[model samples]
Target: MLSLQDYSARDALDLAGLVRSGEVTAAEVRQTALVAAASVESRLAAFTEGPFEQLPAHSSGEFAGVPFVIKDLLITAVGVCGHGGSAALADAAPAEADSTLMRRFRAAGLGLLGTTKSSEFGLSVAADQKWRGPTRNPWDPQRSPGGSSGGSAALVAAGVVPVAHANDGAGSIRIPAAHTGLVGLKPSRGRVPLGPWQQELMYGNVVEFAVTRTVRDTAYLLDLVQGNAPGEKYGAPLPAEPYRDEIADRSPRQLRIAVAAHGWDGQALSPDVRNAIELTASTLADLGHVVEEASPAVDWEGFLAALTTTWCAGTAAAVVPLLKSGTDRDLFEATTVTCAEVGQALNPVDLAVAFDQYNALSQSFGSFHAQWDLWVTPTSVGPAPAIGDFDADNPQYTAAEWVRRCVVPYPTCATSNVTGGPAITLPLAQTADGLPLGVQLSADLYREDIVLRTAAQLERALPWAGRRPVVHVTTETRQR
Candidate 1:
């Protein structure tokens, strides 16, 4: 019998192959995940609830029963209520039906294990939510796991499952992955469906995807879910070939890569993150790729303004639907109310101006790509901050103050979100105290394959699977 210790030893693809080969049943894998979730629930604060019941296997699906967790935000499950971490919407019924993306996840043979917590309205960066508390970092439980996808990242990092569903609007996937030592690939906007409930979100800024332990899992999942649903407002440029196949083909991976060593907003990277990126740049050079210092020229301040515009506007729309009275507004944080008001006060002329700036920012990256194949940078300015560093709900600070504090560690992240490019964060180093450190590789629009190839090469050069966090389910890690 395979002991529980053996269950988390492999990534999802490895387990799925075993499940398909009859060496282990799908139910066994799910039970292992559930036990892992239960074992570390208090310490890590990952999922709100999980239903690990075995589902009938589908012969056509690639995963064929691999256990998976979707974020309790935009995506819905049959019995799982997707409250999206809002107090006002707590009683919202279980989704009448799964979203189109969820249907694809199921069609690909992934078993629905449960739903993970999300930051309220997917608005905050830190994991803390009034609804589910914080999704504690497995690397160090007292520290924060970046969100709104923090719960999903925490579960995968702690070995509850090989991968989990996560969506990125403004660094939610990559930020959490960087903090937790996982591979977070934010595909170009429109690369994955956001539909059946929404055709576009935040003016095409949010993209749905997963964070995983291996490049292959990221690639495979991309292949599994890469397309537009019927009547999607837009679709990504279709891949020339499946992403996994692009990885397996291993075409010569030499190209000019632009590397930025400082924050866009003048925030200097901490020594640890600085060292990691410099080392990564040198390694890329050694791997036969040309490395140079460069970044796309864009209006950073204007980009921020537009992001605020769309985010606040979208929040207003989402929250307004759930509000029935003035008291119902109490169910949300003060920042939420302020953002909605600001968003609601905007006119079409104001929105048009912001969209124009957004498009200009996107084009700046487009022109820069003509000179470089990808851009490399430190994923964060420092190791994970302590949990209370970004208290969006705190009345002591305004919403803008909270957002500024939250983004200081990740000033460059939102640029990619606005530009609609593909960015991947990889764990290649650790802090002096053993916290994970990540270096990001961002490729131009529609070039996810380039980033994947670059990441795969780096993964081989500096393998991270053997390195384990201290707060793992298999064995509790001693905190520093």
Candidate 2:
């Protein structure tokens, strides 16, 4: 039998190796994960559906028998409830079939144990949904684990699972991972299929992925799931080599890395976050990489306009079907309803212009990347914020205002999503009070290799494995 402490200490790859050696049976590892999840879940509130009673049978893939959970949005598994954190869909029938990504997870030997909570319609940066009470950070219970993917991040950070599903339309994956001290990579747009149901989510602005505690876990997972489904409308160029191979070398090539300590619009960051960026810049330079102070020159106003348009329009598309199905608008949060209303008012031309802005921003970032191999910035403006910081249910805010508020503090994440590039957040820095402060590393389209190599290099330079949250499975004390 694998003890809970042993299970919590090992990454997914390690556990898989253990099972392969027959030191622990697959059932024993699953039971250990379930017990660890139970130990911390009361304080973390990290699941929409807790551990499944009828777990999937073990497989013989790369990560065979590793416990995993899916987010309650975008992706689906057959017979699983995916409400996307909305009360209205609580009674909706389970999915009839597995999604493309879900299929890949099973084929790769991951045990599908449960689904985690998400923000309503994946619209908010904080997951304190009015319908489903807040999901707390493992590091600090009073603060959030960052949202839409907050539940997944919390569970992984608390040692419930080594990694869990997370998606990013506008910082959902990276924001949560950054706050919770995990590695979150938003793959190049179209690198992973949005498939059988969606051709492209939010016109390629949204991407599906996961948050993990190590770069190797992220890399290996990407290697397993990165590809196009048959007849896909869009696809990123195939990687030159397996992403896991890219990071295995550990020694990154010396390159020009751009560093930014402030928001793209020159917004102020917390002193601790700013210092972390400076320290990371120095550290990268120490590792023999050429680091300098620079950021891509972006048209801030144009970018925001496009973000507002696409995000609202996407929300409208998802929610209007339910609205027309005669589901009461009252069943939704106020922000969701208002976003649909605003989106309904827009004509096709509005979306066309928004796409145009996305093209221009991509070109501008492309030109900038021609000079710099990577762009590094603070993942969020500061450490994890309190749970109630961004109220998704507030009716007072209009659609545009809501988008602005969400992006203002965590500005860097959406840039890669809009540009169709790859970006990752590394848990390299921390606040004096011990909360993690993630730093963002991004590259031009289809250049995940650069991001991962640099991320692996940094992980070695500043190790984060010794730190554990008070609510973690390895911790004896569980705070509520």
Candidate 3:
């Protein structure tokens, strides 16, 4: 009598193993996931629609029979119209077929549960919505869960699922994972396919991946979903073997790790975040890895400006179509409006110059990676902020001022996006108040397997899987 509620109690691997061992069936897992999703939906508002039907049929893969959720921004079920957290496209039609990623997800045996919420157009760092309201932190409903993958992170951290799909353009995945104490990895650009639509979004900076409870799950999914689809402009070189095999073979090789307590913009890292970095560095050193404080020289101002230009340009492109359809006028958030306006002001020459500068920054990092095997830094400058911290409606500060205050330690996690490198944020530390702190580990481009293997080693060394949030589903509630 394994009911729908029990799915939330175990990780994806556990559920899959249960099915394989005859302890439970795939249907039981899906039912449990749906029940768990229903229980948390109202309080967290993580999903935009039903805890939808399972995949029509299980396929052949490691995670076969496991249940999961996809972020609404990514296409999943046909005719399941996704708003991307925007009311402007509220009437948008469901996609006619599965996106390439969705096809792979199904082939690998992950039962699609439903779609999660995202910031409007995946622009904002906070997942607040003018129509659906905010996706509250399961740990502390008053605080943010982080965005634009806020809803995905919330559900995963709240124990609603073992893992869920999350994409990052600028810290969307890592920020939420840091806030909620989950493992978030932003794969090297082109490592995951984006097809039947476009190759890269946000000018080659954004990539899709999953936020998962375990390192192996992230590695497994990457192996399955990464490849150039029919029309993709580029793809990463395939690994000689599966990523799951890499995780299992733990080689204790000494790795040269460069550590930076300060952010890319040279902003002072908060004591808590700095301490987390220092602690992780020490742990690495103890593990026989060569660790030292160092970072390649970076032109922070130029990098930040270029990032803004690229982001604004993408924003403009997205909104222009909506405006033509008379849909642009419906955007609810003030920041979304401001972003579009800023984007429209840029000319072709300005965009070209920005692209050139981005290239220069990436080259500089390439030179640095020639010296170090990995670079370690704090995932964020400080701990998570309270709700409404980045509210665009607040008149206390202009949009520019708001972005400055909200995105402290400018280019902390965003640097990897600029460099197109593989990075992972591990929940290795916690604040005095019990909020999780993350340490970021980045490797050369296309070296995600190395980064993941390193993460798996550290996961074993630190053993963070046992650390549960103070605010979580109670046994009494789970029993219900």
Best by lDDT: 2
Candidate 1: deviation at residue 96, Å? 1.3
TM-score of each: 0.96, 0.98, 0.95
How many clashes (backbone N, Cα, C below 3 Å) per candidate? 1, 0, 2
Model 2, position 188, has a per-residue lDDT of 92
lDDT agreement with native, every candidate: 0.82, 0.89, 0.79
Q: State the lDDT of candidate 2 residue by residue for 1-480, as single tens digits.
A: 788778888888999999899998888888888888878878888788768856577689999989999999989899887898998798878999999999998888999878898888789999788788899998999999998899999999888899899999989999999999999999998898887888887778889999999999999999999998886777888899999888875555798999998975999989889988998899999999999999887888889999999888888888898999999888899999998888878899999999999989889899999999999998898888898889988889989899998988887899999998999999988899999999999999899999999888888889897779867887743332
Choose the strongest candidate by TM-score.
2
Off by over 4 Å in 2: 476-480
User: Candidate 1 — which residues are off by over 4 angstroms?
Assistant: 54-60, 249-251, 324-327, 476-480
* Ten-residue stretch with the least lDDT total in model 2: 471-480
What 10-residue stretch in candidate 3 is worst by lDDT?
Answer: 470-479
lDDT of 1 by residue, 1-480 (tens): 345577677888888898889998877777777777777877887786665555545645887757889888888766678778778777777777878888888888888888888888788887888765778998988888888899999888888888899998888899999999999999988889887888888778888999999999999989988887788997887898888876674556589999989885566778888889888999999989999998888677787777778877888788776664444877887777777777778888889988999889888888999889999988899888788677767766554555566555786787788888999999988888789998999988899989998898889888999877767768841221
Q: Candidate 3: where are CA atoms >4 Å away?
A: 3-6, 53-55, 328-330, 393-406, 475-480
Report the error of model 2 at residue 478, Å: 7.8
- Per-residue lDDT of 82-190 in model 3, one digit per residue for the tens? 8878888787788888888888888878877778888887877777777678888877778878888988898888777788888998888898998888899999888
Report residue 47 deviation for candidate 2 (angstroms): 1.0
